[model samples]
Target: MNFAIRALRKNEQRVAVLFIMTIYPNKVSASTSPFAFIKDYSGIPREQEILFSTHTVFRVGKIKPTFNYNRLCEVHLTLTDDNDPQLAALTHRMRQELCGSTGWHRLGHLMLKVGEYNQAEELYNELLKKASTDSEKAHIYHQLGCVKDEEGEYKDAALFYEKSLEISRKTLPEDDPSLAAIYTNIGGVYHNVGDYSKALEFYEKARQIKEKALTPNDPSCATSYNNIGSAYYHMLEYIKAVEFYENALEIEEKTLPQNHPLLATSYCNMGSVYKDMGDYLKALEFYEKALKISEKALPPNHPDLATFYGNMGQVYHNISDYPKALEFFKKAHQIKEKALSSNHPSWAAFYNNIGSVYEDMGHYPEALKFYEKALETSEKSLPSNHPELANSYGNIDLATSYGNIGLVYNSMGDYSKALEFYEKGLEITKQASPPNYRGLAASYGNIGLLYRHIGDYSKALEFYDKALKIKEKDLPLDDSDLATSYKDIGSVYHDMGDYIAALEALQNAFQIQQQTLDENDFALSPTYCCFGKIYRGLKDYSRALHYFEKCYTIVQQVLSEKDPALAIIYNNIGDIYRLMGDYETALSFHQKALNIQENVECNPLDCATTYTSYGETYREMKDYSTALIYLQKGLHIREKKLPKHHPDLAVIYHNLAKLYLATQQYNIAMENIQQAMDIAQEKLPLNHQHLLDYRETFEKI
Candidate 1:
């Protein structure tokens, strides 16, 4: 036993290990008597130090709460293998305390406090079955349902909660706190099942009930407030969420002790809302407050501690302090792995979060490695009916990974395969998540982007609208996430030449971002650039240039000069000059954009659109051969970076065909245009304007 303890302290875990069996000095029947005092080590021992002298044995009669361990560990722990009656003494006291039904419930609560969920569940179940009163039954069912919910049997768990509600409704007043709790539990089950509207409905009902029953500022009412807060949080109404969480905290601080778990929960909820609202430092402060109480009140391996760690990790991640995020996430993961099996919903969550940090670092292999592990763990262990299983699948099927792999295939001119995986991921998300779920919105966004890649802006807008409608209802009014959805829709509008719609969307995004983010935030730079492009499309060159300068200044301050996104801003600025017929300025900006990308990306394909812009400029100048050369360079880039049948590839192909004809390669021009026409009609809508143009061009050929 001493050797085992020393090895564990040194962290030298080995397969072969000693086990200790607790023995009682049994004075029972003859056959069981000898067997009880001496037992083999095939057992469970809750603690380690009973092999010392019997003189130190804990006696039953009058005892102190605990002996002082404060004086012990400075000197190395000595293990004596001498026979001792310490285990017998402790066991005798426990048996005396645990002799009745009241005693069982007390011991069971202690087990729950220590996180012995199985023992607690068994004891609670037994007590509930034997319970005599309606109030007791309702309370027992509520707690048992909580244990079931923790086990992720949400529907079955809902039944238990409903049964508790039935009893509470019959025995308790409608506005009783007990009845309000029944409603809250049902709402939580609904929230877990992706029925957020139903969740909101029930949580509101619970709040109203509690508000009527409890006195103003009563801490018991805070449970209802917390319920409402959680529902709003899951619904993505961060501001409203903060309001409710704060209301809960105010009441709690007035009526409950500061160190209570409920107070910590309110603090954590407020912190998460602040974090989502982009107040990282404030989020960190609240998380630390929650952590201080939790560390003192709850066990180190408590599941709530895992949530604290996760929230801390997210706050650090938002601040770009990745090392701090990693440390907290690892601790969260360790505690969760010990407390719950790997397939638990929180376990799946931490794996996805840790994987996202790796994703941000451009470590695609490592990110995918972790995602695959999470998916495998979830799929194998989670019930087929579990919603988290679908979430895991959705994470593994993320569009970014598909887009990356598609680019790889496109580099190999395997456009078909790229499209296949994108379609697969899109289909899975549509089937798995609810209609209003963010996963569904993101899927639509990905499909729209893919359609735009294929030169089907009309089709792109069709999907973008579907995505935007969902995002608008769920995202906060001024949320930064809205920026991307607006930008994507604006780009589709731009391609369709709907300048009014494009300007409205782009300007809305830009205004919201400018309000929410710092002037120098890198994300704001793209928003400015997008607004400039929309203005350029509207033929407002002065306004375009104004926004372009904003973008350029921000980019210069925040991003490296050689960032690939920098090229897009530069080219948009160049386009404004080109449209104004300022050829020298156009060439200057284009050259700077090209120089930056060439140095940083090194892939000619990355600047393919820039080459296309140069070719278009030269064609306007009637320098036909140079235009042909640049357009051909553009085509070679598309061949390297886009699927042969990709709409973007077809656009470049069509441009090259026109340039070829201008250079008098009539037969070659006709051949390329015919292939471009096939790609357009096959991949794009029949009513698509580009499809119409290509068909007309093919007829002329």
Candidate 2:
């Protein structure tokens, strides 16, 4: 290395000889041996990559690329002109002079902020290794824990935080604010693991320590309140959570500026509580206010903005405004897509949200497409057992595909197949998720519906009870989800010849739905239909007619007169009139149902049932010839259009046998009777009334 004189003029000896100092990118001064690793690297690209052991200046472009942790220190700080001893002295003197506590802290903070985490960790490691006091060591450990938390190593974090606390306890006073800081950090780890009780214990510990150390007006006191509120909210204690949240807001509002970020967070938390309580309008108001503030203060693509958009989408979805929901979901999705990397879980999460909106809008094709994309993205980003990976699979199962290709086979009337996917979804939901999970309850309700359709009342009841048990304690008892469980169980009881049980179940369901849902809510129609069918089973024709008429009117009001549900409700009304022996009114109502089914798109099986009812009415009038023709027509359709062993088809087989027997066609009666008996015996229990009726008729044959 070249030496520089203090005052050189044309190579004359005008100054005393001096030792020239040099420094490597490793930050090693000439005073220390260069072998020691004074420089560390984060192993990230686009930074100093260490090379040659000497203090040699090299061109920025002429460097060996960094591999692993060895040489990253030189990549970011390429040496430029090591020939000038004074210039070299600037580097060496900086390293030697900046070696105290302030220098260490500043370097550590700078490295962490600039994303040189490995270098920061190395600095912190050195600080801890050379710490001279318990307080210094505790500070180093606490800072290390913050980095570990950021890296998602919660076990390591807990250890560091605990160590920090232990040392602080031995050295610092019991009421020190440092103790509060450690407690807060430990609580964060517990919260991530879903251990809300442990989280709350630590948060309260922190709060107590903070209260002892500082006045009530301290900003840290507000942080404690906010964190406690979050823990309570996770525990589903919304009232207590709201109280704490409001307390936090009060102090923050009193002290912090109106435009501060903490005020936005407080508004969002209050909005979340209102959303959970099903007060969508109120939730929307608060969420919008938070959105306005965040939009003004945060970057457009910030994660907080994405959260605001997603939460707004939820409010719109709750209000049945699918188009508005789609718009907000898209806004969240675009931000997440750009802000997050292609393989990040956040991108996949927003993909799932947008797909769900497609599902709600009856766009099954688009739903399946996006769900597959989400599943693919999630698999690439997360581990195999990630909860969101299962959700992508579940969404595809519910969104129908080409013909019988989609997740749900509802359009194909394959309720049993749909139940299969529902069971799979439930298993994944429970295994990967927490108790009282809404998705699991939704699957249970779905399986219950399949059992009900197959006339298996016992199995149906078991599943419905399972769903309701999960829902009742978690959601409001009057929530739409619980109301569905009540309605399904009531329908099962009505089908099982338990009218009193059906009435009790259906009435409770109707009351809850009426209380919680909009007056024109579509959920009301099913409850009304269940009530009507229960009355009809009890043979209270007048009450049945009243309930059925109410159902029809409401269905038309909500879904329009030409809707398929309206046609189906009309058929139910016709059945009650037929049972009442009001032939003229029964015929009129049946004709209206047939007209709707024939002219408008309706379920083929339901249309066939209308023919079966017409045949039964003709037989009761003793018009044997017309009854035989109509019964044969119903039987033909049921056999061709329905599953081989369908319960509804069995009903048609029984009616056909009865019509033939009345016409004195004994051989034809025997053939149809055997068909009915085989189907009923295979599909239903011996104690079932359908089987009982068919068995007596077969004995006569």
Candidate No. with top TM-score? 1
Predict model 1's lDDT versus the native: 0.69
Q: Candidate 1 residues 151-268, lDDT tens each?
A: 6567667888988988888877777766777788788887776567778898888788877877879766787788788878877777678788888898888766566667789889
Give the least accurate 10-residue stretch of model 2, judged by summed lDDT: 397-406
- Which window of ten consecutive residues has the lowest lDDT sum in model 1? 69-78
Clash count, one per candidate: 1, 12
For candidate 1, the per-residue lDDT at 9 reads 59
What's model 2's TM-score?
0.56
Model 2 agreement with the true structure over 1-701: per-residue lDDT tens digits = 02232234334634333222344554544564433432465364454434455754433333233343221222333444435454454345335423236778768865543335567778899888888988888888987887666544566778899999999999877778879989998998777555667789999999999888888987679889989998998776777889999999898778665555566788888888877755666688889888987775555666667888998987776555667788998898777765545654445456666666665554656765776676566456435444431333333322211211223344345666656556655665566433425666766776777776656668889989998898887776656667778888887876666778889988888787677566545446667778788877777889888878876765564354554556677778878888999877777877788887787645566777888888888888888788777777777877765567767777777887887787788998899888888877776756666788899888876
lDDT scores in order: 0.69, 0.69
The alpha-carbon deviation from the true structure for residue 288 of candidate 1, after best TM-score superposition, in angstroms, is 5.6
